[model samples]
Structure formats: structure tokens, C-alpha cells
Target: MTDEQIREYFEKVDKNINESGYHLTNVFATAETPSFCYSTGIFKSFNIPEIFISSLPPGLCSEIIENYVEAFKESKEAKRNQRLDFLTERFPVYLIDVPVPSLKEYVLSSIKIYGDEEYKYLQVIYPDTKGNFPNDAGYDYDQEIMGEFNN
Candidate 1:
């Protein structure tokens, strides 16, 4: 994007962040990558790790992230490695720590918006219909759809 476009986009995001507590960014899928969505201002507003989810439609991802943020705000107990069964009825989702190396590649907008300061992030991952995660045997989903989770 051009500098002017980037500035306008950031301004819009800032406006949303000011109106609500956060702004959700939905990235459309490309031929080589699956769709993903993330939240900006979660950490700045709640002191919690920002949320990220992949391989899901933008609407569903937005719902999950918004709900998760609400839950975290109410209880302040959500954290990495936690299994959240309430996000989806079809399957439970796991929150994994997003490695530093992956942040630049995936959550660059958040990085820029947050002034490139240190902040935490958690990746929401769900298993296939068989209830098997990426590293588990019998997992049937395409691994590329979820991107790389070094953690």
C-alpha cells in the first residue's frame, strides 16, 4: 500500500480503537496463504496478549476474537496454553504463545500501531473434526492453512 493509504487505514483503525476497546484486522487469503484475523489494542487496553486466529472465515474469526476479549476482560484469567471450549461448539480451541519471529510476518499492523514495542500475543488453534491438532497423529486438516506454530 502507498504511504497515504497506510496512513488512512491506520487512522481508521485508531478511530475504531478509540470508539471500542480494539480493532480487528481481517486479512483475506491468497493463493499461498489462508485467511487470518487478529485484534489490535487488546494488549494496550487490557494488558493481555493480542489474539490471532487463522484458517477461518473473517466473520467467525471476528466473533471468536471479540468474545474472547470480552471474557478476558471480565475474568482476566485467559492465557497461553489454555483450552477454550466456549469459542466454538464444533471443537475446542487452544491458545498457544506466538513466537517473536512470527510476529513480523503475521501481525505487522499491530506492531506498527503499537509503536514496535514489546507486546504479547496468543494464537488460537482448533483441531480437525477428529479432535486432533497439528502435531498429533490422525490430524486430517491441511497444515498450511494454519500457518507455522513454532510453539
Candidate 2:
């Protein structure tokens, strides 16, 4: 799709979500690929971020709005839930942090698995600091085997 077409489709999803009474906090589109991601927060608050990523090559653009609408409907039904639960239930999201201030090594090491034949895309949604990666996310970031289940 052309840039204009991509913009139009994203706007359609945004309109649909806004009409449903939820506020969209951010939408990030990649210029290199036909992929776009968006996050929704409760009543315009940014404390909670529920992200959705879609890869709309060319023909699949038609379902963008429908997908967003369905997600919005489901989210409304499961109101005030944990974003971590919502994400991990659908995707293989995990936490990895090497102790002794070498987290960069661990993150890069795990990201290597994304290049393997099985995984098509890898989306890492991290906050500004390591301290911000949600404490109650079931595991401590300081300990864990990197890429154990991700690969």
C-alpha cells in the first residue's frame, strides 16, 4: 500500500477506537515494513498501555478496522484488567535481564533468536528504564534464561 493508503487505514482504526470511547495513546508505524502498532490507555491515561501490532502487507488492509473494532469490544468486556496478562496470553512475551549491569548483552543475545527461521517478527515493548518493566509480571527480570521459550 502507498503511504496515503496506510495513513487512511490507520486513521480509520483510530476513528473506530475513539468512537468506542477509549483513548489511543500512541501509534507507531514502520517505514521499512507494512506494520503498525498502537497502544490504548484507560480514559486517556497513559499508566496502562495495551498494545496491538499488525502487519498489513497489501491485501490485508481491508481488515484493519474490523480487527481494531473486535479488539476494542473484547477489551471493553474485560475492563480494568492487567495489560501483562492480556499480552502474554496471546503472545510469547518474556522478561530477561542479566545482573551486574549487563542487561544490554542479554537483550541483544535474546534478540538473536528473532533471526531464526521460526519467528517472523519480534516486538519488544520496554519502558524508559529497566525499573519500569512491570514488577508483578510473574518473573523477576534480573533472573531467567534468555530466549528459553522465545526461540
Candidate 3:
């Protein structure tokens, strides 16, 4: 997408969030090019994901979380397990208490493999496993990563 289109896309997203009175600053994923990415935010406290479904614009919450919803839906275990009933209902809750590396790998791999030009301007929506990120190094590294995708 051209720079103007990208700018317009973000403007719309900002307008939506701004109307809600709570803006999420740190949630988004990049697909392929650095020129644009899917951006959205989730509220988490103490590493637990929270969803105020009513606060999200109509259908926007589902669009942002379709990936995780589908993954759980397709899982046989997730279906049979009574414990996962809440997830099956599509409530916004954090299910992964374990923070395994494979889970992280799966998420990152999914984005890398599926991201494409058609999704260049899609607005969308991770937490760190490690305890408090280092002050200087973590901030610098995050800036570096953001820079890589902000071009």
C-alpha cells in the first residue's frame, strides 16, 4: 500500500479506539513488509489477557482474535476437554499459563507463514515470558524491532 493509504488506515483505527476512551499502545503484528502491519491492542494485567467485549467496536474484537479462536476450535483435545468450554465460547481469556517455547514458535511461525500483501493494511492485535524486561537492553531492543517494521 502507498504511504497515504497506510496513514489513512491508522487514522481510522485511532478514531475507533479514541471514541472508546481507552487506547491500546502495544499490540500489533507485522506480516511481510515493514511499510504496514496489522495493529490492535489487548488489555492484560499481571500477564493475564483481558477482554472487555463491549468496549471493542462491533466485530473488531473477533477480527483481532480470529487466529487464536480458530486454533482452539480445530483442536480435538480442546473440544473434548470440559475445562476448555469457556474458550470454546470465545470469551477473551488467557489460556496459556505455561508459556512454553513451542507456543511462542507456533504464533510467530503462523504470522511469518501467512502474512501477505493483501493483508498489508489490516488492523489487528504477546506478552513476555521473562520477568521484568531489562531496562536499557530491553527498551533498546524493542525500539530496534519496532524500527525494523515501521519503515
Alpha-carbon TM-score of each model against the true structure:
0.86, 0.24, 0.27
**Tens-digit lDDT string for candidate 3 (6-103):** 67756765564456421232224355322212223221111112221212333444444444334433442222111232332433222222222212
lDDT (CA) per prediction: 0.76, 0.32, 0.29
Q: In model 1, how large is the Cα lDDT of residue 137?
A: 79
Quality of model 3 by C-alpha lDDT: 0.29
Error of 1 at 151 (Å): 12
Of the candidates shown, which would achieve the greatest TM-score relative to the real structure?
A: 1
Which runs in model 1 stand beyond 4 Å of their true positions? 143-151
- Can you list the residue pairs that collide in candidate 1? none
Better of 2 and 3 by TM-score: 3
How does residue 137 of candidate 2 score in lDDT? 47
What range of 10 consecutive residues in model 1 has the weakest lDDT sum? 142-151
Q: How many backbone clashes does candidate 3 have?
A: 2
**Off by more than 4 A, model 3:** 20-39, 44-82, 90-94, 97-151
Model number with the top lDDT: 1
